[model samples]
Structures are given as structure tokens and as C-alpha cells.
Target: MESYASSSARPDRAEPCPRSAVSHGVGLAGLAGLALWTVLAWRYGMDGPHAGIFASVVACGVPMLLWSLLVDRVHRRPSTGIDWSGPRRSAREGFDISVVKLAGLWATWGAIALFYGTARWYWDGGYSYAMQLFGWAVVPLLLASIPYVIWLDRYLIEPRDGAYAFGQWVIGGAAGKPPEGAIGDHLRAWGVKAFFLAFMLSITPANFANVIGWRTGDPLAGPVELANFLITILFMIDVSFATIGYMLTCKPLDAHIRSANPHMAGWIAALICYPPFVLMGNGGPLDYHRGTAEWDMWFAGNAAMLWIWGGLLVLLTAVYAWATVAFGLRFSNLTHRGIITHGPYRWTRHPAYLSKNLFWWLSVMPFLSTTGNWVDVVRNCTLLGITSAIYYWRARTEEQHLSEDPDYRAYHAWMERRGVVTRALAALTRWSGRGSPAAHPERG
Candidate 1:
């Protein structure tokens, strides 16, 4: 084993990069080049046959050819400046503006291209009917995105630029200084928050459009449309509650919750749930046919399941509302309250996370029993699982930050002692074992 000192002395050389690094670098370079050329061709109005040939060459071959010759230039630099472990807050004033400006442009053109391509095919033959409907459902999202982009650019970005002067002019005390916490350095958090808020808001219009299109038989199917509709509604409710909680606990949105990083959790949750909407809207793997528009046996059963499960999600949202309001009432100071193992926390350290999973799971009930639809169910469930995993990690990181607090340690210990989850698991295991014995009898 290498000594710590030896390892420290030549960190880069201690464990040299894998032999396949060159191949991996080449692959990435090729991909980026392909993407760039594809964008260029689309911009230049490429047509069929010749356009297809030229696009393939530019998008696939050109990047590879260039990368093969100038690998050093292609793979010269690694990304830097992101301090994942750094302080959570900063004083930067207008950082959000630049981010919104750039991401807005990218999202705008990308959305246009996506919609145009999908629409052309959809109108051509309905061969990809499911995909076209999904795309149409996303139209409202595009509509809402415009205001959101402007909002971020105005409220977030502009302020960060001349915020220092503005702050000094507005306040007699600490006028010129950046607002507390590590000034300027943590503005990236604000940028992240602005991006997510805009993104989430953008979805609402699309969801509305989807419901309308489905009702009118314009493409988006009934089952797929219903699934996305409920999920989007739940998400909107969640954000509304969170915002209320924030306002109730913190000051005006402008005052507290200004730093981006700490507020990023909500945005992260949005990102976690976004893609599943598209996947579920695409009608799963097997082209599910509910037969006719009339209510059938399967339809009735699934509809009942949807109501029951969706009701449970409504209950969960209520739980979120209560918990969020309670959090504000308890920790209005914006500081972490140790382990926070109270109320819903007592049942599970993160009830909000579990509730989020519940909502998505409920949304998948319509397709749960169908064979191919299982793919949609699994895809949605996986998204929830991954999101929960991310929250678990964030919870640990938070615990580390607040570990010095005696109350937190006590709460942690109490939660551990409860062992509610372990008991539940044990019961499940016993039940499973008993069922197997009954089914198989004594094999010997």
C-alpha cells in the first residue's frame, strides 16, 4: 500500500488515468462535434436525401475525423471552478441573469426544433401518434416558458450585477457590502434556483394544452394524458405549498431564500419528476389499447385505482402542507433544526420525499397491471427511487453540517431507536416466507 505521504506527493501520477481514457475522450469529442454540426445543419435548412447525407457526415464523421487527428486539443482541458464542498451562500448580485440568458436561449431553440420535428411527423401519418400527442401536451410548457425567462432575467440576473450599489443605496447599514454569507461566491445557487423555477413554471402551460388536446381528440391519448395531468397538478401543489412555507417562515422572497444553493432542493425535486411525464405520456412499450372510448372492465378498474391512488396523493400533499407549515412555525429562523425528527419526521425522517414518491406511484396505477405498460410504471418508479436516493444523500450532508447541535444528535438517536422501518421489513419477510411454505408444502 502506498503511504499517505507518497500518495499526497504525486496525486495525479499515484493512480494514472485508465488506458481507455483516450477512447472515452475521443468518443465525447465526436459526440460534441456531431451535436454542433447537427445544430448547424438544422439552422441552414437541410433537406431530404442530400441533406440527410451531409448531416450524417457532418454530425457523425467530421467530429471523429477531427478528434482522431487533434486528440490533445480536443481533450486539453478539464472543467473547474465548481466548489461542490464550498460554503452554501454567497453575495453575488446579478449572477442569475447570465445563467437565465444562456439557458433560456438553448431551451428556446431546442424546444422549437423538437416541436417542429415531432409535429411534421405527427401530421404526416400518425405512425408515431403517441409521440406526437406527447409533444403537443408539452406545448403549454413552451408558452409559459417565455414569462419565466423574463422573470429570471429581470429579478435574479439584473440585481446581481449592480446589487452592491443598490443594496448600499437602499440600506443605511451594510449598504455597500454584499448581503451576508460569503458574498459573490455563492450566486451560482441563485442561478440554479432561477433556472429550475422557470423550468417548472414552463410545464404548466403544456400540461393544460395536453388536457385540452386529449379532450378534443387532437392526438394526446386519454390514459397517457390523464397520467401526466395528475402528476403535473401534484407538482404544482407541492411548489405552491413550499413557497407558502418559505414566505411564512422566511421574509419576503427577496429578503431570505435569496441564495441559490440552499433553495436548490425544490428545483432538484422538479428535475427528478420532469422526464417521467414524457416517458409515461409516450404510451409505454406495448401500445396499450383501451379498445374503444367507452368504459370497459379494465378501464373501470384502472379508473377506480386512479381515484383511490390519486386520493392518497392528495392526502400526501396535505401532509406536505402540514409539515411545511409546521417547519416554518418551528424553525422560522432559517437554520437547520438538528435532526428535525418530529411530526411527519417522526414517522420517516423525510416525509416530503416519501410523499413525492407516493404521488408518482399513484399516477402510474392506470397502467400497472398491463404487461407492456409495466415499462412506464418501472420508469416512473425508478425516477422516484433515484430522487429518494439523492435526498438521502443530501440529508446526510445536512446532518454533517448540523452535527454539532445536541438536539439534532438526540433526535437522530430517537429515530434510530424507533426502528419502525425495520419492524415493517421484518413483518414483510415473515409474511413472504409463510406464503412460500403454504404454496410449496414440505418438499422433502
Candidate 2:
């Protein structure tokens, strides 16, 4: 008999089937439940503080249970190449495979569901009790499908000749020989993980406190207060996702550490915008509060204007969150975990960075400073400009690294030719006698 992994001999190789109707139904049900929960919460208020937490569990658990039942049924059947039934089969042989696959699926899904559900609860200001419940119930169930997904890939979906075991990948095991890398590469990975871990810790709880304030009827009497609230929530989600993606996942999801920013300039430019460093040296001007009073004064007594500005701020923050969500479990800074082309990425190459900078420009009103001094105004604007420029540089460096992969190269070309922002940028550069922006090697 031909090996399962061999593509040359067998014409009709076994493959894992596509998601079942039951799975689709479960997903739809989850969405509908979320919508209903949102409407009800908005109308009558939540079931109390822990309502979202409860909803999150159900949302994640039910779908998982349903999907597992399906997988168990399918696996029990005697499929052509993946038959578990045999005249000489021993009870231990069946037990090992079944237990390992199920256990792996449960563990992975449980972690994902809990983290995301908690994040959602905080984001909704604990008022979206029903939505939180949906998150709790649905996310885990969705994630629980992974182990069976691997099983299908190995036994039914792909040619299994050299396939790695489903159990191995679940526990962060690699299939082949360990990748060779210099000590610096390992150090960089550790550093990157540590930085994001600290970033999350610093922001998550602080933002959650802000959410609680919002929920408890704290006075958001002005546009600045509302904008700050929304901004804090957005950063909380971003930092949480980044922290989990970098620190919690199995080895397979980890970005292959090709290289770190060897240039001192890169480190200085990026780190200065974050904590500790942001508190030191010329970084004071980069602080978001440097112009907040001016912004508040400009919108004073103009409720309509405040509302419009606040709405724009929220929209920009939503875009940033959309990009983060698109990354799922792969989000992190200064690292490549394959080029994502979905969500906000479909419209622009740097949606998160663009949205974030725009938000700061509006919220900070860098053109106006508290001191009313020309020098302070100039310094604030310049610092913000430099921050924006730094992010642009980060985007360029990321593209340069990702271009080494074929998928990223194709994505780059497609974005250059068709993406709204890149296309407009190329045209502007051409109009300015700079030639096409795509002419730059890194642009591709």
C-alpha cells in the first residue's frame, strides 16, 4: 500500500472533510446570540458585573462541545485510510490517540476562550453582559476545532507520509530538526516577549479601571474624557492581544526570528514612544497630554463639535482594533508571523499605524500647546511628526523582512497596485517628481 503522505501513487487520498453544517449552524447561532444580547443590554442594562463573564463561558463552551461530538463520531467511523477498527486492535492503542487529541483540543481552546472573553468583558465596559456571555460560550468552541483540524490534515486531508503527530504540535513541539539560529536571535525573541509582557501588564489593568469608571457612571463631562476612555479601551485590547499572541501560543504560532533591529536608530525610535523611555529625555513632548487642554478649550461649549470629534476618535480606534483582531493569535510588534491580508489590511498596508497616528493628532491637537509659546507648539508638533515618521519606518522595515516570503511579496505587489492608501501614495510620489513610490525596492 502507498504511504498516506505520498502524492505520486494514490489518486484518491484521504482528506479531512470541510466543516459540517452543524458547525456552521453553531457559528451562526453564536452570532445571533451576541446580537440579541447587545440589544437587550442596551435596552434594559446587564445582569450585573459578572454577567459578561458568564456569557463568555457559554459562548465558548457550547460550540466546543458540539464540535467535539462531531469529531468523535467521525473518528469512530472506519474511514478508508484512517481506520481505527481492526481485528488485532488493542484497547490501549485506541485510548492513547483518542485521549491525546481530545486533551490537546480542550487545553488550547480553554486558554483562548478565557483570555478573549475576559478582554471582551472589559471592552464592553461590563455593560454588555449578553455579548460577554456569547464570547465566553463561542470562542472556545471555535478554537476547540483545532486538534481535529490537525488530525484531519494528517490523516484525511493531507498526504500523511511524513506528517507530524497532532499531539506534538499541540504542545509546542516541532516536526523536524530544531532551527539553527545565533544566540542573538534567541535573545531577541526573549527580549521581544518580555517587552510586550510588560507592556500588557502596564496597560491592561489601568484600562480596566477606566472601563469600570465608565460603567459606574463616572463623569465623562467633556470630549477629552470620552476620547480618553475610548482610547484606553482600544489600547487595552491591542496590548492584551499582543501579549497573548507573543507569550501564550504553541511553538508553531511563534514568529520565526529571522533578525532583530540591529540598528541603534531603530531601537531608539521605537522604544522612545513607549514607557520608561517615554518618561525620559525629549520624550515629554511626545506625551499625549501635552496639548489636551488646548483641545478641550477649542471644543468647549460646542457639544455637537465634541460629539463629531469623539466619534472620529472612536472610529479610528476601532480601525486599530480591527487590524489587531485580524491577526488573531499572531499579533506582536517588530516581528513577522506571516503577512495578514484580511480586515483593515485589505484596505491599507498600515491601517493600525495610520489610524493610531491620526487619532493622536486629533486628540492631542499637537498644533496647540498649554504654554501658548511658539517653541512649545513647535516642539509638540515636531515630536508627533517624528513619532509618525518612526512608525512609517517600522512599516518599511517590516515589509523588507516579509518580502523574503513569497506570500508577502505577492501581497506587497497587490497592495502597491490596488490598495487605496498605497495607490494614492504612489500617485502623490509620482506627482512630486519622486517617481512611483513603488520604485523604491522596499515598497514592493
Candidate 3:
């Protein structure tokens, strides 16, 4: 099945409005305030003994509320006309400069704050029951800000030229209208969403249960516990973002899914890695720590070394989450809202997959198991290897599907030539070849 690009002609495009700057500024200020609050809370340790709730409100809730109000007011004004000539601007020129700068700034600061806050929470002996309850209660409220922010971008902050930044990543510059797919494509979209929904539901209880376990003073010791806690939190964040991105915001305006992967092999490989289907596989869910007897054996006994490993795991997890953050309201497995070329994508074509696979290898320790038998090690390694291969296939299939679009093709070419991974590999090959017989043909 071939995926087509959107039409070049869009009569509905809107003109640039000076009022958009006001909305953009207000939205940006709110993001800045939230980021600052998070940083301050982490740095100063939330003031008093009972200050967590207040801190959360100040850090996340208040600014978002203000931003929402300002955005609503901005949208109440008369609508602007479409700017047909706006498409002539370069990709960089097309984006609202204020939005782009603010989104990047806020995303960077927010990620740093979240990482520091989460690490501090775990390292300082976890949270009390009241504190945990307060924290969890505040999560949904904080997440509520996402749709509002997206709404502001859609209706107020973004230019009528269809140019806007989604949390540090800019999309839309001479990009055509999204293609209307066949009934089969629509069914595929529904099917993909259904699978993600099921996946999210299946993992929800386990993540929350972990939180409860931490609150109840479960026997979580050293880095393993820390790693597990961080993973759970990151997973929860992903689930929330992915669920909202897939279910709520997927529409013709900003969230329109351009295409779904029609390859059966891609679906089978990707789907089998999650949920009840994962149970069908012997290795179980591509997560090395789960469904294995040797989970604890991977951690070092030394606290310092364990902490280092735990920190590394958290970093990897953060990178994985950063990819999702870059996607913003467009994240999903089978659909392509747009091609992201910033954030973690700036470094690797598949940052999430690469980091996730590395994380599994580190945390799962496939080389070591309970039994001394090499067979067990081999089996475990094979399972993980297959899972990794599946992701590789998924990436390739996605690339094939996306390559049909000119924007994606341009992005792919740029990444191939200038991306970090590509450059690093080229350097490595050059270094290795320098010492080889092939480099010294006369001596040979």
C-alpha cells in the first residue's frame, strides 16, 4: 500500500495575525513559569515539610490556568484570512519565531526539572503516603495542561500559514494537506489506536501498583529499585501522552494522521512485543527484568556502582521520553502525523528504540541468569535479539512509508548525511580501516 502526500492547494490557510504574538507570549510565559517553579522546587526542596502540594500547584497548576485563560481570550477575537503566499517562506522562516524559541526553551528546562525532581524523590528515600497521594493527584491536573497548550497553538498562537512548533520541534512548511485515505486506511488507524489503548490499559495497573508499593515501603533497595521507579514514572508519562495524542487530539487540524503502516510484518512484529500477545512469546514482553527469574542478579552489590548504573538507566529512559515529548500531540505507533527532526531525533533516527534496546541490555543482563547453563543465556539473548530485530524492522517499514512524502525524504537525506549516529559510525569505520592491511596495500 502506498502513502500519498497532502494536496498542495489549501484554501483554508489563515493569514498572519499580530495578536498571535500576544497569545504566543502569554503561552510562553506560562511555560517559563512552570519550568522555573519546577527548578526552584527541586533546588530548594519545596520549602516546608508540608509544602509538596503547594509547590505542585505553584509549579504546574497556576501558570497553566492563566495560560488557558489568556489563550481563550485571544481566540475570541475575529478570525483572520488565510495567507496563500505564506508557503513561499522557508521552513525556518515559516515557523512563528516566538513559539519556536519558547517551545525549545521550555522543553529543555522542563525535562531537566523532571529528571532532577524524580531522581531527588527516589534518592531521598521515596515519598510518604500523603505526599505520594498528593503527587499522583497532581499528575492528571498537570497533564490537563497539555490539551490546553495544544489548543492555544492550534487556535491562537500558531500562524494562519500552518506553521507552528510542537514542543521544540517545528512542522509544516509548504507541506500539503493530509490525504484522505481509503476505508482500509481508516480501519487501520482505528486498529492501531485500539492496540495502543489496550496496551495502555494493560500497563496502567502495574505502574500505579508500583507507585503504591513504593509508598507502602516495599523492599526496594539500591539502584534496582531506583531504576524500576524511574521506568514506571516514564512509562506513565508515555502512556498519558500517547493516549491523549492518539485518542483526543487526532483530527484534521493538527493531529491528523497522515498514514498508517499497512505492512502486516510491521504490525505483527510491533504488536507481539506488547501485552497479551507478548505472553505468547517465551521471553515475555521484550523487557528483560520482567518474566525472568534473574532480574535482581543484574544489579551490582556496591551502592555507588549501582547508583551510577541507575543514573545511566534513568538517562536512557529520559531520552526515550524526550522522543515522545518531541512528538507532543502526534505520537502513535502506526500513524504519521509528521516527521520530527529535532530533540532526540536530531541525534538518532530512532532514539527511542536505540535507548530502549540499550536499556534492556543493561538492566536485563541477558548474559547472566539464575542457571549456570549456557542454554538459558542463549535463549534469553535470542529472545531479546529477536525483539530488537523486530524494532529494526519496524523502523525500516516506517521509513519506507514516510519516504513517500517529500518532507520525510528531505529529513531522511539530511539525517543520513549529518546525523550524529551516521557521523559517529563513519568516524569509527575510518579509524578501524586506518590500522588495517587494506590501508597499507604496499606493505601487504
Q: Per-residue lDDT for 1-444 in model 2, tens only?
A: 000001111112243221211223333333344345434543555544443322322432233334424543423432223433332334454344445454444554455446545653334532243334445656665566554444433333222211123333444433332224433343454455545544554344444344444653443666667776777656645544444455432222222333454444555556766655663234375554554364457787898897788889889998887666555444666655545665556566677877888987887787876777777788778877877776777666656656666766665555544444444555677789856466343411
Single out the weakest 10-residue window by summed lDDT for candidate 3: 1-10
Q: Give per-residue lDDT, candidate 1, residue 430.
A: 74
Query: Runs in model 3 with CA error above 4 Å?
Result: 1-181, 216-221, 279-300, 426-444
lDDT of 1 at 58: 44
Q: Which lDDT tens digits does candidate 3 get at residues 40-131?
A: 54455443423333322343334433553444442233322222232444444434443543443345435533643564332232223333
Model 3: number of clashes?
4
Question: After superposing candidate 1, which stretches have Cα over 4 Å from the reference?
Answer: 1-181, 184-237, 245-310, 329-342, 366-407, 422-444
- Model 3: what TM-score? 0.56
Q: Each prediction's Cα RMSD?
A: 22.5, 12.4, 15.6
For lDDT, candidate 1 versus 2, the one ahead is 2
Could you tell me every candidate's TM-score relative to the true structure? 0.37, 0.58, 0.56
The per-residue C-alpha lDDT of model 1 at residue 370 equals 51
In the predicted model 3, the residue pairs found to clash are 6-177, 13-82, 14-82, 15-81
Global lDDT scores for all candidate models: 0.38, 0.50, 0.50
